[model samples]
Target: MDDEVTTPDGLRLAVVQRGDRSGPTVVAVHGYPDDRHVWDGVADVLAGSGHHVVTYDVRGHGRSDSPPGRAGYDLELLAADLRAVCDAVSPDRPVHLLAHDWGGCQAWHAVTGDALAGRVASLTSISGPCLDHVGLFLRRRSPRDLPAVLRQALHSWYTLAFRLPVLPELLWRSGTLPGALVRRERVPRPSTRDGLRGLELYRRNMARGLGRPEPRHTGVPVQVLVPLRDAYVTPALAVSATTFADDVAVRYLPGGHWVVRQRPELVARCVAEHVAAAEGDPGTEAPALRRARARGAALAAEGGRAGPASRWSGALAVVTGAGSGIGRATAQELADRGARVVVVDLDPAGAAETAGAIARRHGRHRAVAEILDVADDAAVAALATRVATEHGVPDLVVNNAGIAVAGPFADTGADEWRRIVDVNLWGVVHGCRHFGELMRSHGEGGHLVNVASAAAYLPSRVLPAYSTTKAAVLMLSECLRAELADDGIGVTALCPGFVNTPITTHARFAGADDAEQETRRRAAAAAYTRRGYSPERVARRLLRAVEKNLPLAPVTAEAHAGLLASRLSPTLTRALARVEPR
Candidate 1:
């Protein structure tokens, strides 16, 4: 349904409503030079999920009527316009507010000031901050925050240009402004009036609030979706906003100012999660919402520096083959450090056990289990989709599934080689291909840890199949790291030597009789047990490698020595490969 709502100042605003009116109402607001249609993708998504979605054009943009003078576009009047729409849409109930750019600026004023007080249940701000907060942030900036402040100032050059007298109006009227927006934002060419009338937003409201900023605060839960690549608003502004909000959650994404157009599904998912959490229904809360609640307040309040540990405090991680050995240990290590973990394994019972242990240690929702054979491309794709749909895009992905096969190349059968290669090499391939796509699609950078092995460079003739697969994995990691570097995604190859694990007991000894195979398995397991290295130690090293973004890491002392020897003394390594194990 489309209707016209007149604000207190006599400006008529265009409003569109969708979904059942009986459901929770959500009001979405757009920024300058854009209309309610900017939220078309997000609105349909939320509406499909049973929420009553509302999007309105700001005064002086889209179908809304522009007021006569600069005084009409003041933040106070703009806030009143927001209130008017909220009142018309949900007269008896509070509405969840989602806004971008200028709309977010006005929404911040309304939510923080006395205008909408209890009328706004929650706010999900995208690429915008309150002008007063920005003012206070600049004033309070120390040497540590100077660079970020300056960077933000540089990004705000357009704002200063907009304040210039007739130049901005001329650019808009000549279609130059609209062309730029079309090129950059991929949005439909906006009306010239959108640009010309919106100039007052910068002229009247920008500099006025910087001089005598009020101590504005909001009790409403706030989720800030920061586009890290936004040309106008720095992510630092989102972090700074924590000071004024009682409860705040900050998520960093990878997009420019117009992410709503570039990645609309991601925007919708984030907004839905925030609204669901604010509604006080835990059952309806998404993983992102749960993580946000767990993250608590921003780090700025405590005066602590932010890093992977702090950033991933409440983030989600997905680990494959997390049933036993290094996989299980890595899953436990991550969960203990405050990340919600998804434990995936081929064995259903093993996966459930890992999940149960994590849940018992952390909260019940901190860990979940999924059964999968990582070699299955379709299955891996489905898992990736399900995780993104249910848990949001994972912040870290560990492709740790593998199998062990031991024997000389001449004795190993084709079937044995295929079995080992399928699980060891193809498993990692499936995980990376599917989950990596999800990370890229979400427009948020993530980490991928592929578990290779020390045999990758050790040059073992007896362990032909095993070493070949591990070597391929190592090479794959290097290639992926180079490819994804520009996108902020990090890929690492984790190589661990002999460590006490169940892999030895389950390893296949090609060309051996049944009795001899069992004997070899037992002997291999005993060798690993005597080595005294543990899977937990390897797991810890894996975490560090990811945190540091190491391209290639060799865990055990032997692994490190082998890597050095492979590079510095290849002749010696090749000579050693000819020596057969007893």
Candidate 2:
């Protein structure tokens, strides 16, 4: 339905409502240079989910009546308009607020002040920070924060341009501004009138709000969606809302400034999750939302013993082969960062030892042990379901379980080849398949790290079976990375060389007698010991790879050199593969 909401200032704002009238109300407010139509895509999705979605144009935009002068565009007046609309729409119930850009600024003002006290249930702000919060953030900046401040200042350059007398208005009127937005942000063509009148928002509020900002606080739950690629707002500035709000969650999304238009389904999913979290039973809050709580508040609630805050705090991670070597080290590293880790290994003693060590350092709740053979698809799928039901979906998954095989290709029988491929290749495949789907269904992004080897790319004669399996894993990781990009999941292939680990002791050597196999194993182990590389180093690189979302991470000096050589000269690599070890 379409109607006119008359604000106390005598301006008539155009309002549109959709979805079931009996459902909980969600009021969506659009940013500058956009009208109620900016929320069309989001509203449709929310409406389908049974939310009474409402969208409206603020004063001086769309069908709304323009104020007589710039003085009428004060922040207080904008807050009052929000109050008048909420009172007219649903006076009995507290409505959830979803806002973008300038609309978020107004919503922040309303919720922070008494204008909408007890009237707003929750607030979801996208690409917009409260002017007062931004002011306080700048006022409290230190030397270490100079880079962040500078980045934000560069983003706000257009805010300064808007302060100019008539240049901004001319740009909008000439279609230059709208054209730029379409080309740069991929947003639909915006109306010139909305662009022209919205300038008052900057002129009337920017200086006063940021220069002498008030101590604004809100008791309402707030979710700040920080778009990593936002052109107008830096993620640091966008997340500053955590400073003032009592209950706040900051979620980092992958998109530009106009993410609402670019990824409406994603925006809607996040908004709905926040709204449900606000309205549902507190005990049943989503794990992602719980982890996203402001660092200070979460730490204080936990009795201030969670150690220093980290990006991985409260995250859940699953690592296979966590009994020894790189897998155990990675599990411990994640736990040190405040993540709850699930340590899975075929050996019960190894898994228990890893988990026990983590528990000793970070409390008993920090880690759990599970026995699993990764080659079994059914078992892995069952584990994925159980983990989701009992511990929530994992935010990070590391598939590091594998066996090694050595000796000539001709001597490697079908059974030996099958055994190595089952553990090395199929194990990674099962982890990615089950857990990747769970992450996609949850609508929140996660990371996957698959452990390959330098043998994946470097030609090898003595390690033909091992090289083939590792190569297949590397190719699988690359393909999955491309396929899962749109779903927000990251896939990384970790290739390490000559790490001092127990794999050498267990490797099977084809065509060799039992005694000869044992001798070769001792020789290989001694050579690796001489190289002096540690699994802990590979663990650190794995974390960095996930953090940066790197497609392929080559650890150890030899791994890097081998990768370069294989890519630069195929003939030389092949010739080197023919040399027999002494």
Candidate 3:
């Protein structure tokens, strides 16, 4: 049953207490930018099994009191509210606390203190920080303040404008909120229904406690479920949280912070396993739980990008076409993440510029820019041999070198077609033929990433040659992946949309002059070119795919939509494709 409770301070909290009135109890906390619905799935599972599950809208969220002012809006206040709820909800039994995102920080505070720590049976911190690896996070993001800092860097104007009180009010009224919402059932429209209170909570939290580090653990048994694609918290934090507490269980989920909505089953199972172990069920394996416990403590030692476990330290990765494109973007991302990169490009100045920028950003030896034409098989072969000897099988090989040419088949000459095929298609072939063998002979395993395009399957008549070459590259990569799977080497075919890159300047049109053609084609093509994401986005997604051992990476709206539509009906796809707007 749901009820409203007014605290001593006059803040009204919406509380959800369901299941048999007499049963074991659990408390679920939600972090910033969200509400208590984050625990709806886990609560349901627990309730069905006769556990008294408790959830409430954190202050300033979900019809909770948005107490005006930053004075009472920090972690301390959040923790106080939690303790009060504990006293009010389940004073008899030791409560099992489940927290995610920022709520995990409050859990760290609530479950660690003497009184609550002893009464709490177990604590699960999902995708929040215990700040055990600050040095590593600082290094990963050169300038520091990785999470909110990166958001500020990305959304500069929002930071400047959102701080003004009542400013979001005007924008919220402009229909910007509803347009931003794609699915109303799950995702609320802009500002959202039952959302302003949450926004106010976030506003005060950010305004007052932006720089405060999360409080350390209360020494309770903690289980940390880290999402592989979390943008705010680093994996280093999840792995390191165990350093402070002796019993920490680390698990990986295959979703975003919105896993409550995206992969509820996975989240529910993880919660079940953690609860089973805590409850000391004879059916659960204790030794295996200990192994999981050890991972939260020492996996950082195994996967640390900087500390002693940095085997890839100073190792060189050869990246081709390293200019102001995906090549440059990947070079920066790798360098930032700790890897020696050999920037290869036909443009000496361009390569030098990229290397210089990377060095400036990361404050290390980012890359050695070498001018070369990858299409020339001998040049690429020699470069591979040099890179192998220079840096042991080039731990990672990203074949992101390619060119694009677009025109009607009538206007495109054999020369134009062959040039595109030579660079886009054969370049990948050269990379595989040479690097694949070098890697197999070198050691345990390595990753080979090939950059294809969405045009491969979702064919585009406007870009015939480029699409054909990309299609060939996609097929080649899949074949290589199957062939190499047994040899301990992994292959990933990356098919991204029209990323915002310089190549868009050459994109063609049917019959107009260059100026008019660009103007006409710019809108649809501009989807990824103007407000479109950077090559860094694709690079990040590619790295994540490699970590998860994914075979194909389709990285764009058109790519994902086409795949979904085709999977639904291929022949019907052809019919629908004819009607799709250009």
Candidate 4:
């Protein structure tokens, strides 16, 4: 059940209760520009499973009171609201606190503040960091007051262009963008659009205050979650907060800005591990970290994989978004090398074709394709249950359903924008949340394959949101890589450069369906189509990256070149990039 509590400062806060009141209570503080609903994934896991979870809108965001203007938007005020929520919700209990983004900053403040200091048994900070170094997030904040509002009106051409007077009017009234963003991140997706008004609040006040500083002064056991590719909070920034405390433990997972929505189970497991530790249960062991590097070294020593390799030969493998491209290639590759493949896709016909082809070549039953949409939460959960029951717990799971998006940030319609994010990015998240839990419980270590892009590493002006989502995917994958490493689950990030796929057709263009754009993409992909390797080439690279336990995998010579340019000679890459007319 859920209800709203007014903060002492007169802000309305939403608090959700799960299980009995006596259970461990976790106050989850979500970051800037987002509401309490940000914690829905983590909240559900805790509540439905018996722990007590409380979530609330933070000042300007979500369903909470926005007040009249910027007068209420400041660091101290934001931190104060968090304390008020805790006081109102679980004043007596030794609460477990989980925070992400801005909430992480507030949690840092709470741990340091005189009020609730030492009251928290354990804390988890996700994709946020110490306040001082949060220049990355700060650089993007909106200025205070009317000037700030005007700044959004001016510099935020992307947001303005997305809906404009017409589309924006419709989206705001219909609440499509906010609702879709929320629904995309939630497991089986959340129902209410309560605090969703905060997206505009965030856009208007892009200038959210700095996050909590490092907890060096606090002695509470801590868990810090960092997404290596986060656009707002860099991993370095997240790591800086750890230096403040001695009891720091870290878990990194895959996905971006809103990872909890996509991979709730992964977040749930890690959060549960921390809470269980605070409650004094035997801790989730960390074996993979100590030995993953050595294992990768051993595989390299043995020369490439001979079949399924020792790590996953007998393991059940579930590959989703497998109708074509890397998904299709990976599924068939696994079957050819002898791992049973469960080919999953939203397109049943495409999936069946892939499955039938696999059958004819491998002699009947080597692979099976099931039609499904991962964005649909119930569908994902059902798939997880069915796979566990039919194929047994899959030792390997791949989140690969992705579509291509191309266009200037402006003209892409809301539905176009929402669908790309839901499928390409969030789909993997849903799979990880549901399937990851199933694999973890089976007691057999499993591997997760998330298909992020080379785009994950950099922000592209042309494909603003698409690039933004990939960056999130990269970070989310990296976070999972770190956390699951100890669990003997090797996480591989398939970060590919441009490959020939149908992603081109779906590319959201600015003007008409101009022939020029198609011609350009064709010419660019022609480079690959010429000496081009099949998607199987990428699949092979992916398998090798997994066996080698590489933290990141780039798929093309162009990708390797870009890495050298981005890392070794930034100016050269910039100059070369500008060599072509924009």
- Candidate No. with top TM-score: 2
lDDT of 2 by residue, 332-421 (tens): 988887789999999999999999999999999899999999999999999999999888888899999999899999999999998899
Q: Weakest 10 consecutive residues, lDDT, candidate 2?
A: 299-308
Higher-scoring candidate on TM-score, 2 or 3: 2
Query: Compared with the true structure, what per-residue lDDT tens digits does model 3 show for residues 242-286?
Result: 555656676655455555555655565556566667777634533
Model 2 TM-score, all chains together: 0.91
For each candidate, give its TM-score against the true structure.
0.80, 0.91, 0.49, 0.46
Query: Which RMSD values do the candidates have, in order?
Result: 4.7, 3.1, 17.2, 18.6
Q: How close is candidate 1 to the true structure, as a TM-score?
A: 0.80
Task: Answer with 2 or 4, whichever has the higher lDDT.
Answer: 2
Judged by lDDT relative to the true structure, which candidate is superior, 1 or 2? 2
Counted clashes in each candidate structure:
0, 0, 3, 29
Candidate 1: misplaced stretches above 4 Å? 47-51, 139-154, 164-178, 211-215, 249-254, 276-280, 296-310, 342-360, 363-395, 430-447, 457-460, 475-492, 497-541, 544-582
Off by over 4 Å in 4: 1-312, 514-528, 570-582
Candidate 2 vs 3: which has more lDDT: 2
Task: Give one digit per residue, the lDDT tens place, for model 4 in 1-582.
Answer: 667778667878666666667788888877644666667777887787778888776766555666665456555666677677777678887788888875776677567566576578878888755454343323333333334234323533543344233565466467675566556544333323333343443333334332332223467777776554354554434544444554666444555657777567777777776677668643333322212222222233333112244344333578887887778888888877656688998888889988898898875656878899988878999989987766666767888888766666676778877888888778878888898787566433568888888777654556666777777788888898787764556677778787766555445554446787677567555654675657888888888887677877888887776766778887775565444233
Please give the lDDT score at residue 148 for candidate 2: 74
